[model samples]
Target: MLKPYQVYNTHSLSLCYNDYLLLQLLLCFWSSLFSLCLSLARNTKKILYLLQVAHKNSSMAKSICFCLQKLVFFILLSAIVSHARPPQVLPRQEPSYLKFVFNATDLPSEDYYDYIVVGGGTAGCPLAASLSHTFRVLLLERGGIAYGKANLMTQDGFLSTLVEVNAFDSPAQAFTSEDGVPNARGRVLGGSSAINAGFYSRADMDFYKNSGINWDLKLVNESYDWVERAIVFRPELKNWQSAVRDGLLEAGVDPYNGFSLDHIPGTKIGGSTFDSFGRRHSAADLLLYARAANIRVGVYASVERVLLASTTPFSGSRQSAIGVVFRDSNGRYHHAMVRRHGEVILSAGAIGSPQLLLLSGVGPRPQLSAWGIPVARHSPYVGQFLYDNPRNGISIVPSIPLEHSLIQVVGITEDGAYIEAASNIIPFASPARSVFIHTPSSPLYLTVATLMEKIVGPVSSGSLRLGSLDVRVNPIIRFNYFNNPVDVRRCVNGTRKLAGVLRSRSMEDFKFRDWFGNRDFRFVGPALPVNQTDEDQMADFCRRTVSTIWHYHGGCVVGKVVDGDFMVMGMNGLRVVDGSVFGVSPGTNPQATLMMMGRYVGMKIIRDRLRYS
Candidate 1:
């Protein structure tokens, strides 16, 4: 008989050899299949005809093809499972423009600039960067910097960053809508862009044609290119994302557009702000393009209100925004005034812009009086027309381990609904850890993947009002989700489509087989209704599960609060140039267009100034 240790070593070696051989075979098969696919891609019609004929004949060739396809998929799945976890330690680097950024506490009691841009978030960063090329600008942010924060800088930490909220000074600020749905907003320098899923897509053509602002198409494209060159990257699709893409096609989302940055009707892979090494690049990076000497960025600078003065001595004369009063982190107040012919711009997002305007006494006269605020301008529409796209979806735990992924592939349906997916690892308490015990138990986590849908251009809307005298407090708002019949119908259709995706052949491996041999998905939360055709049940599901995708907009909208030029109505030296001016949300994700708008408006301002000078 062989010795016990010798027997164990022999068995381990034998298994290792078998695994090595299998890996080599898989790699060879995958390489050959990839080349074949590339050739077929050049002539799609021929490939489709071949597939059709094979299906009709049901011959040996069809069987061989099916086996080969399954083998390739298995190989890809194995690779994904082997490397599902991301690296724990990544190299973090600070941007060169940090030299130009300073803490608000260090600023003088009073300062002057050619332009004062409030809220150094998504739009404000690019806007300040663009203006710095030709004019002096001051970009003030109410939050701290995003760089050097690991949670905000890595793809694996996306969810963790959003949940780390506090009463003050957290990267994310939490709030609940009057509709009873919980939500969070970015309180960092990059705004939502720093904390979002990193999906980057341009606005739809209809957005440009319908928006009240007169856009220069050439300049728009140029601005997009500028942003893309700095941050956007083509994502590497893994098994979960690849399966979702195939499932979308199988469910008839149709005409796979492949990898693209444009918003088109089909299943496509969109650009991401996270690079290949899993590091994120947010809108704050846009400042690298700015002329550092001409721009000053102050973090932890919260503007209390716009300083408005009557342009003429007579009463009823138009009031102009001459400056702003802001408080630093140390509680010291400072005045940032604009020079002659200078402007004060508000890029303070949809929520912040309107709330600031209301606090400055620019809303309805009666409402302001009730709040004990003197009316600076009687702009009745300052806090009206608030909207947030309602997101509803289902989450499931896969039978096989899956990698963590953010929004990468998007399925754009022709019926005005967009579908997306994300997989995340969440830590939860184990049963062994008692609530009263001070000692912690071993760490346990659950991997949950989601398939979600949101309707395009929701017709239902609501309003916002003041909640507190403190500027840091969240405002009272409600986005009456699914109030319109049209939105409800769209949600019903979208949910049914998700049901189809769950049933697709591409999703078969992810399902769990019960003792009776019935394969079904193990849902993490609520599952889709069995009778998808029941519109009432589907609509009820939508209403109950409705949540915000954080794509809210429209308070200081165009034609009501601001004009086509983005200037505040009946107010001189003031302009609102962020999502607040958007009458409708653009494309699937608004960060791409929001950043583009910042650059676009900045260029327009420069051109107008130069021409008149």
Candidate 2:
């Protein structure tokens, strides 16, 4: 056991490390500024000396030299003060609950808890925290904590973190769907919330009405309020985001909704997890509310499978989950068992929860037989009905430079399309090297500003299957984009809405003049079809440019894999309480809803336990 003083020392060291990095950045900035100043001083001195030498007693020359020297000095002073301002220091205080978090390798071979919550992600963290209020809880995260990582903590590092891949420890895990579109999943403590664009919006009323879960409307609102109070913030709009908002309104997107967290049909500036100072507040931060004494967070603890034993009279047919076997970072395994009447919850998002169920022999019987794994329960829909909202849009290079921004303004069209905008500065390899070679040492970069639209409640769906026996390997996921005609029509309508926005008068300043003096938007990728009225052309564009907005859900869905209470059907002591239960992606972004589900379900579980006891 660590002494209290020793724990304090450790936390102090972590804070110091962050301060050290900040100091280094400041030093580098000052050094560059000093070098430039020295060079400018030398040039000014030479100029003044030459002027004096050319006109030995000319007062005009002296006056010119004086003015030049003053001008140069003023410019240098301004540059130093304006450009060399130190970066905003991140919040120094670590969460008090972090004291309960431990490296998985440091844990014993076996442990017992009232609840074992897998995946310390957007949903899992809050779920585990809420559970901790009334019961001993264990939260297991496959990846390390995001607390001190500057890249995951700040808005400026959003795109950079998403683009970082090809490493086992990279926060964003890259995967290409069978549809051949590139996508990413968060591998860090906060899951996708840590690596996402940080947009926050509540689910639409239709979501709750369609969600099958028996929700207490008052509690639902309260749960959303709980999450909002902790993490959500009102974003200050910049040039690009403001223009998108105006253009959306000009294109008939509605009566402006202004700033709101509610999901309403109109152009509105929604909440963000990125605060005014640009630091991100992910779902992992919700752990701060946990009862530290009751909650234990184990990082780098990858759950291999849920352990099951016969529940019937030695029949070995009917089984229930009693514990889980997880592998530590060092490849050593540990067991976490639930105590009497305790449960094991899978809050591992849409992909992970289903994948885990299959791995634990709870999937289709034939699939388990092929893998030589014993079938604990036959769940046909464990990995079925996978859906990813296909994001189709156009990226354009603005005529005037725009400040970097993520999704702030959203246009909810009555035609079942949601439009959003982001301006990102993406790094690229120099021309001499392959574009695939993305290294921090590479100096080249490109500013990609985009207007994207995603359809609401896409009817198209597919499935997820094991790609490899290894849990670390990404599964074979095929979302079957635009598989349904309804989805295609929605996409076409959304694309048409985007075209309308581009044609709006508000976008005129962003358009560039061509060689023939015809002003047009300079497209970074494929431009919108010339004939927006052509449904066939618009449909083709939607199919061709279909990409993931990372709003994928389903698999282990309610009423099929799990019941309305979120417990796995035909199984006891096992429940899935994540985005997997979402029949349709909620609102504009699912992060807010996913986070709310964690708190909501956890509170429900506590209430049920109290009533039964």
How far residue 172's Cα lies from its native spot in candidate 1, in Å, is: 0.8
What's the C-alpha lDDT at position 459 in model 2?
89
Candidate 2 colliding pairs: none
Q: Count clashing residue pairs in model 1.
A: 0
Local distance difference test, each candidate: 0.83, 0.82
C-alpha lDDT of candidate 1 relative to the true structure: 0.83
For candidate 1, give the lDDT of residue 492.
Answer: 89
**Residues 1-613 of candidate 2: C-alpha lDDT, one tens digit per residue:** 6321112222111111112333354345446555756776879878667677759767666666555554444343333222221124355467666788888888779989999999999999889999999999999988887777776777767765766576466888889999998888888888999999999999999898888888898888988999999999999998889999999999999889999998999999999999988789999889989998898888888998998887668645667889999998899999999998899999888889999999999999998888888888999998998989999999875666566689999999887999999986443323254323345333333445799999888889999988877888888999999999999999988888888899898899877654335677757558888988998999999999888999999998889999989999988889998888888778579999989989998999999999999
Among these predictions, the greatest lDDT belongs to 1
- 474-505 per-residue lDDT for model 1 (tens digits): 99998999999999998888888888788899
